[model samples]
Target: MAEHPAYPVGLRLTGRRVVVLGGGQVAQRRLPALIAAGADIILVSPEVTPSVQAMADAGEITWHQRPYEEGDLADAWYALIATGDTEANTRASAEAERNRVWCVRSDDADEATAWTPATGHSEGVTVAVLTTDARGRDPRHTAAIRDAVVEGLRDGTLVAPHHRTRTPGVALVGGGPGDPDLITVRGRRLLAEADVVIADRLGPRDLLAELPPHVEVIDAAKIPYGRFMAQEAINNALIEHAKQGKSVVRLKGGDPYVFGRGMEELQALAEVGIPCTVVPGISSSISVPSAAGIPVTHRGVAHEFTVVSGHVAPDDERSLVDWPALARLTGTLVILMGVDKIGKIAEALVAHGKPADTPVALVQEGTTAAQRRVDATLATVAETVRTEDVKPPAVIVIGEVVKVGPTATAPRE
Candidate 1:
């Protein structure tokens, strides 16, 4: 018999019975999609993989916990025959055929009534690819095609302006430490969809270059104690652009909630009744230290890690951090925005209880090509920063975990 071209159509199986003949790897892969389709799934197998068992435990599916019966396909809108038992799968496939239920056979697609396509989703659109030839089908090739289409849609390389629905609002996107690739997929997609991007100086700077010429890029860099854009002005700018019917993205370095003053921006937008979407990014507090080969927490070295903002001096009334309490802790202490006040911070820590010789490391411009690590003890960190001319936008790590990694043995600048 000559092979005929398969007609492709999506099945609406919500609240309908779908029989799964196996509980092994093949069933494990197919069940989630079935559940997602809102199918009332039935699994007939004596045993199942741990992950499949988890789904059953979670009340996501019904488990028969027995061998396939002759009438297992009864009332099933669709069937998947993936039992490792050859005879059982063949029998199940025959039952599906007699009942006219579309079946997918894991062992033999040629004999099955239906073939699952390689499917992907991007921004409310689903991309499904199926390829067949005289010899057989290439599942991997089909998946690759599906991936390419989905990626293109996600990054704005493929655009159907007529098909897309544009909503004017603000998205608080965290661009991650510094690398453009480090940005989250959702954050990058929002950037691709944005009409106006108000960005910080620290996050993924290179991503701005990739934007189309129509995109308006605003420099909202709030450099500490330098030429800066005021917070009030930035808030007004977001409100102004969004009111003009444009999609605005406030892209900040690291996670927005982590000392990024993201809440203030959100509250300001909330007062005017403009909706905002927050996409979290990898915080530099933990990532910067890791990039420089320092683990904030280590087994038998440090049990806990505390992240503190050192923008204010320990002696300053505006400072909220308890220097005495922090100095007494045995775990790692990661400080941000402390370059200018490192001397006072060091003095307060030592004067309270922290040993002067505690190991410390500062990772400057972390996760970028210009990344560098400076090492010193608590006693000498102030003078070290002075002699080394260390700048802002660096993570300062204090504790024994700094001395645990391989960088501890490496030469210091």
Candidate 2:
């Protein structure tokens, strides 16, 4: 009779010896999950990637610093054969079989006794996918399913829990750069469980519509600037709502501390003895330019990138930024909230000795379906902005890196 299929089980490998008989890319990819599972990993390899070496330096894993030997799997409960050599992997698997230990061979999964499932975690729940057929398991199929499940969890389409305890508290969740998919798993989970969502104009607005009907959605901009409620009033609103035992989520765009005034709100909440939690989001300064296919710091094009707020013009008395210093640097300059002041900003940079022809890219509504890019130079960006009618909430990238992309050419009118 044919043998039964491989039993799928979640191994409780905490503090257990898990021998990894390689230190190549496969091992590098699998080590993180092994570490997360609390396994005492012993990596046997003559050389490892810098990341694996760093992990060893940090005491997260032990490196044998040599090729696989006959007794490598002696005490190992599990083994991973990922060496570049197929023969080495086969020998390691044989040793694991001799020791009655299951072995996962990255080089030839079908020849091994175990397979690593595509895995993801959300809000304390771990999802693992393993696809097996007459031939063997398909990693691509398993990973696709895993990604779909995690995507559903992040977007709230996958129903887990609508109500977590209604304990009075505040969670400062960074909603990531515009894309709802980019938000952290913790941030998304908290958003689903919030009793009141105080949201920003630039955050993941699509997520607000997904909240349960019972969850109150507060437009932060309307609550304060639109309705004449000051920052103090907004803070009071949080304190008052939480005092009534409601969970308040301050969902802001990008990272809360990246010129988002998240600390100001945190301080306000602290003065009233309200406990707050901050979940960092992906900053647009970096992600936005990336979405437009612009690298803020490229290997030889640019070495450093500076992120600054452009709400105030460089010539304004209230402006705190040193325009001359910024102009002197031959690096990338990322400006947020600067569309309105583009004319004056560009002039100041050029006047301050930034190359008049320095390339600039304006990414509007970056990382979203409506994202658009307008390219120009420091000398012509003002006219380009006018020509394109680029609005606020756009990221302005300035530097030589802008001219290094595949399609980058002379500035367009």
Candidate 3:
């Protein structure tokens, strides 16, 4: 009779010994997942990639630092023999077999007793896909299927059995710059559970398209034009929705605390005795410049980086910023909501003692498909802004750190 198929089961590898008999690309790819699983990983190899070596140095894993010995699998519950040397892989596999431990062969999967599946996780659900044909199965095909399942789970096309309860409360979720993929896993999971999403114009809008048809979407920008009224109305909407026993997600771009007025909303909810949760997002102040290939801070270039709101012009009486002190300080200055007042802001900075030739970068719609960069010096940035017609929702970076990193651009004369 034919043998039964390999029964699928989840392994609780927390604190369990997992022996990896290689330190090449295969090991590098597998180590991270194993680390996430809380495995007690012991890597046996003569040399390792820089990243794997860093992991060992950080005490995340143990490095054997030599060829695999026959008895290395003594107490290993699982083993992966992926050494480039055929003889070493053979020895490791044989030792695992002698100890009755499940062995996965990276070099010769056909001879192995176990196979790694294409895996992904969404909303606490782990999906693992394995092909029946061991000899010539396409990994990319399996991976694509895994990705489709994950996307479905994330976008609410597929639902998990243990989905989060649609609690009647507010979640202030930071959408993370502009990239849909940049959002936190918890934020995505909470979004899937949202019955009403009060969204900002700058938040990841692509995700909204994936929401279930039953979900209510409110636009913060459409709530009357005066800034104070608009924010007050948004706060009212959150309380109103949650009071009606509906789950509300206040989806904002970047971080809620980074000039997002998240605390104000929380305080409003608290006044009504409504419990709220805040899931922080990747702030655009740093991510946007990085997307344009600029680091906000660099070693010896700028020790400190300051992010300021340019919504109010420096000369405005309501503005509390010390422009002269800012100009005198020597570090990176990142300005948000400053595109409309770039000319005045630039002039003020230069007048106060900031060098006219300080490099500046204007990253528009950063981390998105339409991301564009305009490079200039502080003296000429105003003109560059006018010439390029740079729009709002852009990040303005000023400092020598702009000259460092991969995407550094030459300043315009």
Candidate 4:
């Protein structure tokens, strides 16, 4: 036998018979890729791992529930010999060779007619890598290479200009909390593909620095009570850039729909017949509390949790929140954009029958390096904010659930 370089080729096994001679870990791993390829999979084994049996139960594959036979490869376009039984695997491999079918042996790669390459997919591109040498094979090294290539492609570090197919549209991507790594994969990929990114000050700011130099980065910072970009103007920017045949990504902090005015932008885009993609993000309402070791709902403590915007005072005519109704409920209340009105909000809750001694936590800049938690009673929360010098972009958690987590023992301000 001569050692030679292996020729790599993709198999179009859709609707073709693929016989798997085992039901153990190896079969468990290979069955998914086979099923994903639309292959008609047949598993011949008396016993199978729970995961492999699940595939049979789901009708994803046919289970023979018996040992492999000589004629098992009669109609198989491909065979995977991974029963882990020396005699059985050898017998199956010989049968596959006799039938002139491509076979992969889990126990002996040298005897296998085909090898599975380390594979990955990114942006509609499939990468397959195989390292073959006289010194033998290194599957782990091959997989590492595959991962590096896929990650580089995803983060816009390694440019494959010829593979790009630009599509002009508006993507309302939720940047997720305040961490760059927390953004959704689709959102990050769209950001990499963006020609113009209209970013909010709240989202993963670090990600913007990674964008290609050719990309246009616009500051749409909506600072509270400060210089901000108007909502209408932001919408116009999206419409104008998209109309000019450019991909526009409106990156927002937290979830776009959660008090982020994402719907306003979407509706504005819709009016002009511009296509829009809404990628939901992790809202600060819940994530911020969690980051500070506070569970919004704890067993036997809070059965329901409500998220409210505190941007408007309860006494304001523009306010829509039912502060009285909220006070009546026994569940946890998570407040966003309420730092400025914490005193008024605390007063309203107490006046509406909510206990003045109800536990309160303000997690500032949650999930970021500057994150800090301040504790106080509902009655003292206003003074606590003033004394602690808490600022905007903090999540105010109210109710007994705040006292149920690790932050329960935190010193009150």
Best by lDDT: 1
Candidate-wise lDDT, in order = 0.90, 0.88, 0.89, 0.90
Q: TM per model?
A: 0.94, 0.78, 0.79, 0.93
Error of 2 at 4 (Å): 6.0
When summed lDDT is taken over every stretch of 10 residues in candidate 1, the lowest stretch is 221-230
Preferred candidate (TM-score higher): 1 or 3: 1
**Candidate 4 residue-wise lDDT, 308-360, digit = tens:** 99999999999999999999999999999999998999899999999999999
Candidate 4, run of 10 with poorest lDDT: 221-230
Give the CA lDDT, 0 to 100, for residue 123 in model 1.
71
For candidate 2, list the clashing residue pairs, or say none: none
- After superposing candidate 2 on the true structure, give the runs of residues whose Cα lies further than 4 Å from its correct spot: 1-10, 19-31, 42-118, 129-147, 162-167, 224-229
**Candidate order (TM-score):** 1, 4, 3, 2
Task: Write one digit per residue (lDDT tens) for candidate 2, span 1-413.
Answer: 01446678999999999999888898889999999999999999999999999989999999999888889898899999999888888888888888899899887777788878889987677898877562655678889999999878865668665465645899999998899888988899888878999888999999998889999998877774544546767787788888889999999999999998889889988888889999999999999999998999999888999999999998899999999999999889999999999889989988888888888999999999999888999888988888889997899999988888775656875
Number of colliding residue pairs in each model: 0, 0, 0, 0
